[model samples]
Target: MNSLIRYQVEDGLALITLARPPVNALGQTLRAAVLDACQRAASDASVRAIILHGDGKLFSAGADISEFGSAASFAAPSLPDLLSRLTQLDKPLIAALSGLALGGGLELALACGYRIGEPSLRLGLPEISLGLLPGAGGTQRLPRLIGVAPALDMMISGLPIDANRALELGLLDRLAASADTLVEAARAFALDLLGDLAPARPQTPFAEPAASVAEDFFQQYRQTHEPRWKNRLAPRLVLAAVEAACVLPLQAGLERELALFKQAEDSAQSAALRHLFFAEREAGRIPGIAEDIALRPVARVAVIGAGTMGGGIAMNFANAGIPVVVLEQKSEALERGLANVRRNYESSVSRGKLNAEQLEQRMQLLVGTLDYADIADADLVIEAVFEKLEIKQQVFRTLDEVCKPGAILASNTSSLDVDAIAAVTRRPQDVIGLHFFSPANVMRLLEVVRARETAPDVLATTLRLAKRIGKVAVVSGVCFGFIGNRMLEPYNREAHRLVLEGATPARVDGVLTDLGLNMGALTMTDLAGIDVNFLVRDSNRSAFADDASYYRVGDALYSLGRYGQKTGRGFYLYEGRQRRDDDEVVALAERLASELQVERRLIGDAEIHDRCLFMLINEGIQLLDEGIALRAGDIDLVWTNGYGFPAWVGGPLHYAEQLGLDKVLDGIHRYRDSLGTYGQRWFQPAPLLERLVAAGKTRIEKI
Candidate 1:
């Protein structure tokens, strides 16, 4: 096989270019080739210096994360081994970075004698996100070059810093004017280094922070970030590695980092997080869509509401530099929506996330009007209206009449059947569902609900547009609530049942929090408003006709006008955002249990956690078997991104696969036998689940 690294000689300099396609990931093959190239350069009599860069768009997007946990990761000329050799090279080595120098890529740059990068280059060590530390020399070398604080901040957060910030922090030696000039600049830098003829610094004994100060920062970081890092091992492990760098010698610190990296790589958390990372990427791929399918143009966008969801949706387009026309029936509503959008932009400006000029440019892209004609020229029209079926149909009818031919019409409905809405349009293929989560601009998840009649090009175009607007779009077949909310229904149902069966809302929430969820079920319910769920249940009465007790606690709370935090009471009492257990809600549950002659019993934490999680998992299986979800991982992406399902758990279906399908089936059987009718009604094993268990498959992929 040809080498992934290209070696050439020019002007007494060995030029090594990483020639891997796409993002130039540092896999075993690339590493070996790089090492061989370096060896060739070192042995060449004519070569005075070496200049390293990458072909195509990026220097590197970091290590080939797909190789994690595989034997190839530890193959000869491993990243650490190559970096060490580069550091010890007798000839000066210069790195020319253009696009991204992340994780192992940044470590490779740091190992060289001199580093020059394009001004727009993105650099960081983001292994913390995959539940691992930088296994090479990142943990040891970065602090030595840029000081302890900045290095710690970058590693702990896993966020990339721009080249300018990198230069300011001393991470980069110099910045070229543009990517086109990076190589020549690096060549000049290497020649300048040869003229100076200074001996290369030995890579060891990295700089350390004051012992007392380092201790304080780690402690403070753990305390402040503990909630976000709940049930996660990598952040703490990363901190430990960084601390070792502060206290130990370079080799010792690297050894400590390697040990921690191995531990994290083997961890369940790392496996789950890595699964989610791949799942998110897999969500965009449509199995049947042709690779060469032409995508519809979506230059002008229009939104058919000015409420919270509408305003947020409009902001996404405006942020992407696409002009948006927001239409409402009343001018007052339109004005309120425009004001909300302005306030959101101003808040971003206040946080230094955006400047006044950026805010103005974004706001300028938003056009609010009361006339439908204003939006006729829009290529995409999304209706973020109320969740009622009639309202959605009426909006679609109007959109069909007013929207120009080929205009993509979408609904941000959470529960209503998307096909029914599409049925009202003259061009059903143009109708799709772009279900953005609440605070659409901030949240990354967007469920692209593909209707039965939705054209391949429409699906392809919407998925592409979602990326342009900074959204993680997952394709979902037409179904009630699509993927996220459909699975969420069962989870919410079981949460209410658990409370009614004598578990406190706080206890249930606490268990879920411990299990790695950002918030507990009841806590999320309260935040979302109890009446919202009650309204959904009311609208879908036929689906729950067999079980009157379904979501009963929520309905009762809503009946009493205890809407949620906005009303100061629902599942729990809230006093100025502080939630406290309330006697009245508990009494209401007790009364309902007595009326139905349903004996209430104390529920353990494990039971509450399992019942809620398993039911959600069961629903996801049903979605998979019924073809509502394209793949198990896509369902995982929906939950992890849209529903706050812990990424560390790898979403519901993956979690079930990890738990063993046989074990999951056994639990469902046990629940069916114990709960009698209720269990039989809800715990029916999916055909796919039963078949997979029988086949002894441990992963959804095998199924």
Candidate 2:
């Protein structure tokens, strides 16, 4: 073995530690080193077994993300080859998994004959979320170890299961109760495996009936739960890979999985999702601000409203172990709000997600009262009341009156002026906008809107608070809808305009779905509830209809009282939440066109996608130009969080870059000249985009 592999004989067993630092990512260079180590152990006659482990807090964190999608490495036969070498080698290999065993890290363990883990260890295949799959035989090997159905759910969802779940699924051979015993237990398992004269685990050959059931179970599960996965390329491909394990030979299955991995990684979906994954890691940071921002601990949180958002926000805080107090207007309102909160908690309990004890514990922390006096000393107070100026003014006036002066006061205002929300209070410096998406506990994105008069500490506080409750907080300067909704204005406008021109609602949705959105543009409207969409439309109409044209589709639905899910009707009918295109809506489009004296012009899918998506991109550029968003990437983060902006699409601006800067500019101009001003705000390109276009730059990832 080369110098990278230390061939020390520990009682006739080989002890090979992966010396690469920082989670021992198995990039190309490290693969050669690992392969050499495995080969030397296999070749040595005295060595009966090998213990493979890492030096740091993790076994391995998969392939270095930096080398993810590239075609060729300077050295190494790819991640799959390295894993195959480990599995096929004569020496029985044991992996000591600690800290994080994810992606390629877990793949390595699967290749080994035996695996051991500590209680603190986390093992998962998170590639599906990044629009890639486990290329190193994770798909085939995992189901062979665990049952096919459980593996399908795990890999397809891309959510990490802890050590306990990993053990339940048979992913690990043995799990140590404590971290200290993990290595010893792993070594013992290795000895036991080496003692066996049976050959290494080859292709999985489960019984015939079980294999057939596995296929049926997986197919049914995908059809039932992820039928809408029509948009994402990875999920279906991952399902195919998992299915391959039951049929194909081990080596052929590995090859099939690798081909899918390479295909997904290079697909526009994977590139966009990977770009977003990196973008999110850097989203919270500001350039000039010190990396070590002293985050004040928000141990306890208080919400001024007990409405849906307020209750949801409280749940998020409580779920994170932070005590929450919900204050409402009157005794009746407080009681009703508290009831809603309890119902939410009980629902979780009924779902088996939480027990009665946990439900009670969380409910106990959520104290409800009519007075703001209870939360006067709270660390953070978020008001999630109605967006009405008067109602918000009253809440802030009361919050300022009773709450301790230093407590960060936040408003969950979607589009109201944060400056105005701040103006109602004496401590304007402490007031900020924590624009949590609806049902805050479920969403991952939080827009920390900074009012002009807000203090730097307050800005820092909301940013910190966002991360505390498990959200990607993007610092946004105050604007109508801040960043997410601001950009969405143009997107919906162009979608409506496309319908006006020649396409149907289904066609518009089709284009967006092909672009990788989870739902089509019209489908999203239906999902959000037509009434909810109408309310936003009316609000935007009152706010900017005079300056920019309002598409007539939304209000027309509102007039018919077809307000989406609640009414069981919308642009598309929702029959028990199964979305189907509405013929009535198509007729409405025709009627509206006739009323406006506009001829229906047939539009292509590309034009429909560009007009809708490019308008949003243009608006994002404007936000960047006006300094509403700190950087171009922040805008993308907001969209990924709040909107179903496909993480793979990398946000509107990133999509713009992918389409080519010149193309985006040309599309904007063409739409502007053809569609009028509401459509043309997009035609007026931002200086940064123009600069990039002039310089022939096509990617925002570099920035």
Model 2 C-alpha lDDT versus the unseen true structure = 0.79
Give the per-residue lDDT digits (tens) of candidate 1, residues 253-327: 888888888999999889988998988788777988886889999999999999999999999999999999999
What's model 1's overall lDDT?
Answer: 0.87
lDDT (tens digit, per residue) of candidate 2 on 528-607 = 66677666666657666464334687778888998777678887777797777778887887888788766788788778
Best by TM-score: 1
Q: For residue 342, what is the lDDT in candidate 2?
A: 86
Mark the regions of model 2 whose C-alpha exceeds 4 Å error after superposition.
1-9, 19-22, 36-47, 71-74, 190-226, 497-507, 520-562, 568-607, 676-683, 700-703
- What shift in Å separates residue 444 of candidate 2 from its native position after superposition? 1.4
Error of 1 at 532 (Å): 1.0
User: Lowest summed lDDT over 10 consecutive residues: which window, candidate 1?
Assistant: 203-212
How many angstroms is residue 131 displaced in model 2 relative to the true structure, after the best TM-score fit? 1.7
lDDT of each: 0.87, 0.79
Question: What's the TM-score of every candidate structure?
Answer: 0.97, 0.88
